[model samples]
Structures are given as C-alpha cells and as structure tokens.
Target chain A: MFQQAKLHWTQSLHLELFQNSTKWHTLYEESYMDTSRPATQTATQAPPQAQLDIDKLVDEHYDYLFGYALRYFRSRDQVEDLVQETFLAVIEAVKSFEGNSSPRTWMIGILRNKIIDRLRLKCREAEGESIGFEQDLLSHLFDSVEHWISNVGPRVWGSCPEGALKQKQFFSTLEACLGKLPEKMRQIFLLRELDGYERDEICKTLKLSSSNVGVILHRSRLALQHCLQVNWFEEKKARGPQ
Target chain B: MISCQRATELISKRMEEPLSLKEELSLKLHLFICEFCEKFAQQVHLVRSAIKNGSTEPDDSDTHASAEAKERLKDKLKLRS
Candidate 1:
C-alpha cells in the first residue's frame, strides 16, 4: 500500500512526443533570443549545416535528459527547470565544445554537474546511510570484526523463478524492496545500478568519499539481496542441503 | 583468508570499482571455498544487470517524459514556433 503509492507518486508524466513546430533558427538568433544579445550580428563560424541543429539537439535528447533528471527529482517543475538549464547551457557552451566527446556525453556531463550543484544548494538530507541506521541496524547484522552473525548469513535463493523478468510482480516486489532501503542507500543503488553511474561519478555527485560510496553500495546490495530472499526469492523450492 | 563478512563487501565493491590484486585473490579464494558466497555474488550481479536494462515496470508513469515538459524544453531552447 505505502510502497504502491511511492511507486506511483514517482510516475513519469509525458504526452505523445508529437514534434511541435520545428522553427528553422540559427544558434546566434535563438541563443540571443533568450538573452539581451543584439540579434543582428551573425558570428563567424562554420556553416549552420555543419553546426549541430539546436532544435534537433533538444528534440532528440530532451527525453533522455528529462528521465535522467527525474531520477534525482520528483517534482515536474524541477525536472523541466533542470532540463531547460541544461539546454541553455549546451547552446551557450557549444561554441567551446571541443567535439572530443560525443554530443550526448557532453550534454549528460553538463546535466550531471547541474544536478550536483542543485544537490548542494538544496541541501537534501545527508547522503550515505545515517549513523543511526549503521550503529543500530547494520551493527546488528555483523560482529565487532565485521563478520556476518550466524543466521544472518546469505542464504540460497535456489532457482530464480522462471519468466520473473517478464512479470510485473517481480518489479512490484523490487519496488517494495527498494522502498525499504534507507533513502541515501536507495539513491546510491538506483544511481549506480539502474542509472549506470560510475563509482567516482556517484561519489562526486553525492559528495561522498569513494570508500564511503563503496560501503553504502555494499550495504545496499546486501539489504536488497536479503530483502529479495524474504520477499520474493525464498518462496521457491530450495536445492541446497539444509 | 577473508571472512565471509569482508568477502561480501568486496563482492559488492567489485561491481563499482576494480579490486586490488590481493583483495581480488582473497575474494576468488573465499568464493571458491564458500558456495553460498559464490552464489551470493552471482545473484547480486544478476540483479544489477536486470535493473540496468532488462527489468521494466512499463506501467510506471515516470519512465517516459511528460509531453508538457518536452514542449517547455523546446520553447526554452527557443524553438521559435
């Protein structure tokens, strides 16, 4: 119930991607249109044909950027604002773009940095697991020397349920399992696994040390696996000698 | 020999970053002797990969961008008309 609401609460809202009117405009015009730049001067540059189409760029990549930003922000306004900021940034920086990285890579890198800046300003709850969650919950899972307590060790999941990936129940179970995680750990897991963020990138974005990222990731993985065991996996027949 | 405890952390860490050679060797040895830990490592990898591209809850709303947001970005990009 609570989990279901959280899942739906994060729903992505989008209408059919019908191409809105495509206006043929140069970067000089569009870039200046948004700002106070005098509109008449066309800067000397490679032909517009050679330069990437600003309209095409936004049209093609908006959804990717939107979805990526959506991962970090639940607010529709926030997501669009970040995306708008990113598009503006991309155009403004396009002249300086070295063309070494692919356009998508460059744009995403910009978005990532923008998100971190937002994170810093927003001062969202401190990242990584809370000390209380650590001292109370995690300490109970391990001993003083960092060994799993008996009966708390990992268990056999036996055979994974067939066709589970095709089933909605599996994702619901996954969503519920994810909801049980500490906020920071859940974000770390989603960023690292689902969003495909590299460890150092995640560390920088969340403002955590690499090793701290490792710890949070390790614990998140453990909790997720354990959660799956109890909630979904262990229900199946076991093949191991009990 | 790494304890099952530390060995498990290394299991998850290896997913995000490369393990030191010594750490890697210890993990390989621990996983070799401990079937449960070995299975645990594999299962973790399975879940990560599934979440990456294979797993999908198509019914979820946020997976796709809102059309209004798209229009707004186009407008902000100065897609005049």
Candidate 2:
C-alpha cells in the first residue's frame, strides 16, 4: 500500500494520491479528513449569528461538493481544501453567477477548475510526471480480430452482487483502484461516470477528440473492472471452499 | 461476425450515439457467443449504476469539510454580502 494510504482509511480513495514518499507535502496547506463530524452537522450547526440562508445553502450543497471532490482527489485534506475554496470562490462570484446552469452544477464547475489547477501543478512537478499510460495497454487485451485474448479475458463476477456495493469498503477499494489509473483516463472516467457528461461535452471540456474520449472511457472501464475483479470480487472466490 | 474487441467498442459507442442496424446486430451476435464479453458488459452496467447511487449517498468516510472551514467560508461570504 502507498504510504499515504497507510494511515487508517477514512473513506474511499483515501489519502494516497501520487505524491512521492521521499518528500514532505509542504507544497500546500496541511490537512486531513475529519469525518468525526459529519458535514451535514457542520452545515446545520452554523452558529445562531450566521445568516440563515447561507447556512441553508451550505447545509444543502456541502455534501454534494465534498462527494464530487473526493471522486477526483485521493487526499482528505485536498478534498477539504477544494470544497472550502469552492465556497469561498462562490461567495465572490455568486453575484455574477449567471443562473444559466443549476447552482450545484455551477459550484461543481468551479470545483473542477480547482482540481485541474492542482493536477496541472502536479504535471509540472518532475517526480510525479509519469502518468503510466501504456500505449499497448488495450492492444494486449484483444487479439488480431479484436477478440479478447482468451488467456487473459474477463471472468464472470458471479453475477456481481450489486447489493455488496453499499458497504463503504467497496468505495475504498474502488477509489484506490481508480487512483491507480493515469490522470487523464481518471478525469474522463469521472466526468462520464460521476458527472454523467456526454461525449460531446467531454470532448469540448477536455479538448479531446470524440473518438479519443470513447477509447479512453472504454479503456478506463476495463482497467477499473480488472482492478476490482482482482482486489474485491475475486477475493470472494478466493475464500470459496476454504 | 464482429470480434469481441469490435463488439465491445461498439457497445461503448452505443452509449455515445445510436448504432446502425448492421453495427448493432454485429455486436449482439458477438455478445451472444462471448460469455466473457457478456460478463464485461454486465460489469459496466453494474459500475455505472453503482456510481449513480454512490453519488447520492452521504459521506461514509472519516473525512469531510471541517466546521471551521465552513464557518470561515461563511464569514468571508458575509463580507461580500
């Protein structure tokens, strides 16, 4: 397990982002996940003196922002910072905020920009430069006529106990496995899977070709499925007949 | 008959836009014989549904925005108002 992930798991995609183990994380503010107090409580707990509507807004939208932020970042601290930064930005921009997009969606758009800036910073840093996007990754998964290479194709996950997904550990594993993906693939996957963005929109936002979007999306799905099958679902089989 | 790779690619393409009769049939036929691909298909469905559901649920982890952070933002916003 990555050192960042070594700490007690707080939630899915726990704090092990792509940081190198050798250096201190002083590049940004120090923070950690604080699930001890549910955000809902914090939002509603707005002091008696706080404006009522702002409290309501925070109460209503904080979880959605927090959840969306978690999907992109592995660190609890980064997630906390992003959500806080988002609301801060919202206060200044809300006045000019065209009601063109729904408020939550608008907030998410701002949050996405923060995420992109962080990722771009990571990109500039020399140590974390490797994105691990293997060019041959997909080709090996298929044969000459595009059939799966039988020796390493997918297996039935025993009908995939959909009910099992409700447990929190599933998200932990899912996020960890997802965190293993190349950053670009991760971005496209989350946009489609979490935000439900269509291909055209993804292409426009990411400046990717439409076909590139599809290929990356498919490849990401394959990688996540393979990871889950190995780490989670296949574990069930491993314990069978034990 | 389309290969599993072609069929899977077509399957994803179908998500983005409508597939032609020829493309759709080719994929369906390939999926029929390809049990593994069938499983892959189902897995994608399961994942998409899971994400949709997961997003709606509250934080199940130990980390969330701190109350201090919330108050801080509110104080700043109050100044803006």
Candidate 3:
C-alpha cells in the first residue's frame, strides 16, 4: 500500500480543480453520462478470494485516482462515479490480482478501463461534436496556400534542458497547456500520449474513424505545442533565457 | 510537393503510425529544406515526452481527496463489496 504522505502534488492540484471548476461540464454538456445510476449497479456479486485492504487502498489512492480521472473528465460527479466504479471492479477482481504490480497500478488499470467504457457509451450516443473550430485554428497557423505563417510558425525552443521533465514548474505549465485543449481533443491526446493506448484502440474505443482520430490528434499536438511555447518557453525567453 | 502544413501533419501522424512511402519521402524532403518544420517535429517530440512525465510522476502539491468525497466512495464500496 502506498503511503498517504508520499502522495502530494498531483492530488492537491486535482482537488483544487474539482472543487472550484464549473467549466468542466461545458465542454461535454450534451454527452456527460447519466451518472445518476446507482453506484451498486455495476458491482459484481462475486465473493472476494483475497484479503485486499480496501480501506487502506482508498486512503492512499482515492485522490490520485481522482486526479487521474480528472484528466479524462473534469466533472466532480463523473470523476467520483468513475473512481467508485473502479473500486467496485477492484473488489471483484481482487481474487485474480497476483500482486505482480502495485495496488495503485492495478487500480489505475481498472480505472482506465472504466473510462474507456464511459467513452464507448458516449460514442454510442453519436453526438458528433462540431469540430469546425479546428479548421479556423489551421487557417490561423497557415497561409492561404497551406504554408506556415511567419508570426505563428513553430519557433526554435532550443534544446530541452537537462532534467527538464523533473522540474515541477515545467509540469505545472504542461498541465495548464493541456487544460487549454478542447475536452475531446484532450481526451484523444492523453489516451495516446499518457495512457499509451494504441491509435487503433483509441479509434475503436472512441468510435472515431482512423482519419478523424488522426486529425484530432494532430490538432491537439498543434494546440499543446503553441500553448507550451507561449506559456512556458516564451516566458523563459522573456526572463532572459535559462 | 507537400506544403508546410502537410509536413507538420505528417510529423504528428508519424508519431501515431507509420506514414506511406510518398508521405515519408515528402516529409523528409520538406524537413530538409524547412527549418521551421524541423523545429516543429522536435517540439512535438518534446511535448509528448513532457506530458508523459508530467502526468505520471507524483509531485509535492499539498492536496488530497476531500473527506466528504472519500467518505462517499467508501460508503458506496461498502454497499457493493
């Protein structure tokens, strides 16, 4: 079991996000799942074979799982529902958990599956969100003939400094930039970049055609690159370079 | 000839899956002449890794799940398990 003290930064950031944000729902208002279903609706009646410490697991990982789910969903209700669903699944599957991985990792695997299931349900509704704004973003970055515009073209960020990834400030900036992405785009980008889901899995899970997934991923990277540059790299330049 | 826009798309797509022979050649040719697109490719790589690290690594922020939310989840778990 991971100790509570060892878990710190990401939990706090996610706590703040869940408590204070209402804009979380605006991004997918029409498609937010009907989370009002009874929490027991999905729990299996299978008896537990292993003596997994459920309370201790919740104590250590609830916030981390909340934060992880926040990446896929910003709504507090939805995030809570997903975490609950994951724990229920954990209870049923605890018998098969061979301890090859840490409990946290195991729970995360289950939580991701829950998230994918939620996405599959949403995709079934076929809301077909209007991504026309993505076209405007392309025009803003390119000229009429599809060449990069001077002011908006990608700039040299110089080489990544040693241990840049270990820097907390860098992660915060990256998180902010990721938050700026449209929810759908962010969902696809993270499924690829963070969850390490294969592109085919993403297309199948999200009910998007392969080309549509490609286009969304492209737009997301473009947006994230611009946001990171403007918020992190450019700010560093203004401070007279590191 | 692939435009700079097309080159950037291929750059992002290559990260997801392999590009066709024509796409691979055009993107390579575009990067050969286009310093900006070359920089764009590097930036995409940087962004991808940065995100992977930023998300996976635990940090020192002083927050945890609210007691209320935790309690609620516990209650639900008790009901099912």
Q: Which of the numbered candidates is closest to the native, going by highest lDDT? A: 3
Q: After superposition, how far is residue A54 of candidate 1 from its true place, in Å?
A: 7.0
Model 2 lDDT per residue over B1-81, tens place? 767877777777776799999998888888888887887887777777666666443455544656776777667656665
Interface RMSD of each: 4.9, 4.4, 3.6
- How many angstroms is the interface RMSD of candidate 2? 4.4
Clashing pairs in 1: A11-B62, A12-B61, A12-B62, A13-B66, A14-B65, A14-B66, A14-B67, A15-B67
Badly placed stretches (over 4 Å) of model 1 are A1-59, A94-106, A120-129, A135-180, A189-207, A231-242, B1-3, B16-29, B51-59, B62-64, B79-81
Model 3 misplaced stretches (Cα beyond 4 Å) = A1-52, A124-130, A161-163, B56-64
Each candidate: what lDDT?
Answer: 0.64, 0.63, 0.69
Instruction: Tell me the alpha-carbon RMSD of every candidate.
Output: 10.6, 12.5, 11.7
Evaluated at residue A112, the lDDT of candidate 1 is 62
TM-score of 1: 0.62
Q: Name the candidate that leads on DockQ.
A: 3
Clashing pairs in 3: A9-B59, A9-B61, A12-B63
Score chain B of each candidate by TM-score.
0.67, 0.77, 0.73
Q: Lowest summed-lDDT stretch of 10 residues in model 3 chain A?
A: A20-29
Best prediction by TM-score:
3
TM per prediction: 0.62, 0.66, 0.78
Candidate 3 lDDT by residue in tens digits, B1-81: 889989999998899888899999999999999988998898888877776555543343522346797987777776766
lDDT tens digits by residue: candidate 2, A91-187: 6554333232345555556776677556555533423322245446566677777778876687876643675576565666676777788766786
Residue lDDT tens for model 1, A1-242: 22322222122112112222322223234332222334443333434444446567776678777766766666768888888887887776665443323455556667766775776665356643355665665676678877667566666554553355665655667766776776566666776776466889777766778888788888777777777766776553343233
